[model samples]
Target: MKKLFFVGILAALFVGTTNVSAMTEADLRKKFDETVTINGNKYAVSDGDKKLADDYLAKYEVSSDDCDYIAKKIDEAKAILTAEGQEDLTKLSESTKTKLKKLVSDVSANTSVKGTVTSGSVVILNSDGSTFAEVTSLVKQTGTERSNIAIIAGVAFVITLVGACLVVKQVKNSNN
Candidate 1:
């Protein structure tokens, strides 16, 4: 009875906290309209762009080594968000891509895109475990910073598709 009561209480606490904390459309709109100040200049921040920073922030703590790097990336992110810069989204994407291409390798490189086939086929599954933060922090301290690449996720999904085909081949081989 005591155990059940404690479990119920814990469940209620978790549920109560998460339920009301979930943001609604109004809350998201308010967040979108928010401004963030950097280097004495205030810039409007989009909720989506902030989410990108937040994705990095999740893994980042305030560290002397990372403070400057993270801060710099945060600044770049602000530029991207501008909330709106030159009115050229394509230009923004290209610049970020150029800077990151040298520093960041393809994220899906280690993921198995190919498997061997004998009389039987082998199954290979490749998935990207790195979050955007890890990707941003990809070579940190050992620190190689990748300016966010807009097409990286799309590329990763395509790479994963090759592995997905391998899985199908394996399934067919096993059935035979």
Candidate 2:
């Protein structure tokens, strides 16, 4: 009877742990979407302001490892523009800048679109309470950062179950 009871407890523990861990991945994805949307919106808005642009140009020092490569590209472009002279390139420069700004806005819109699609999927899943493989694939594309949360949660849950099992076993042995 005690062995049966132990088995039941362990089974329940395992199932419960897995379910909790699975939910955490969804939660992390939701949080990541929220963060990206907020930050991207702010960046887009700040980039539109002339004062902010001047401030950014004056104070911005590129610190990332990738910054040097980006800076080199910028320098090369500037050298080409300077060689061509501002008078000849003014219209071209304005058009290029406009296109770049539009591209940034489009990218920001894409992020919003992704978030909306994920939210819609969540709503549909909740209404039906069904776990479709397609939904899982969508979440997976959001990146491993979301998936890693689930892994961490699963590990925590297993550790907790093992601790509980040890306690239960000790209790049962003492009673025996």
**128, model 2: CA deviation in Å?**
22
TM-score of each: 0.26, 0.22
lDDT of 2 at 149: 97
lDDT of 1: 0.33
Candidates in order have lDDT scores of: 0.33, 0.31
Writing each residue's lDDT as its tens digit, candidate 1 over 100-119 gives 23111221122112111112
Model 1, backbone clash pairs (residues 3+ apart or across chains), number? 3
The numbered model that scores best in lDDT is 1
User: What's model 1's TM-score?
Assistant: 0.26
Which regions of candidate 1 fall more than 4 Å away from where they truly are?
1-44, 55-62, 72-85, 93-96, 100-129, 132-176
lDDT of 2 by residue, 1-176 (tens): 00111111111111111122234645423322221121112111111122322232233222333233333333343344344343322234554444333332332233211111232121111113342111111123545887899999999999999999999999999999
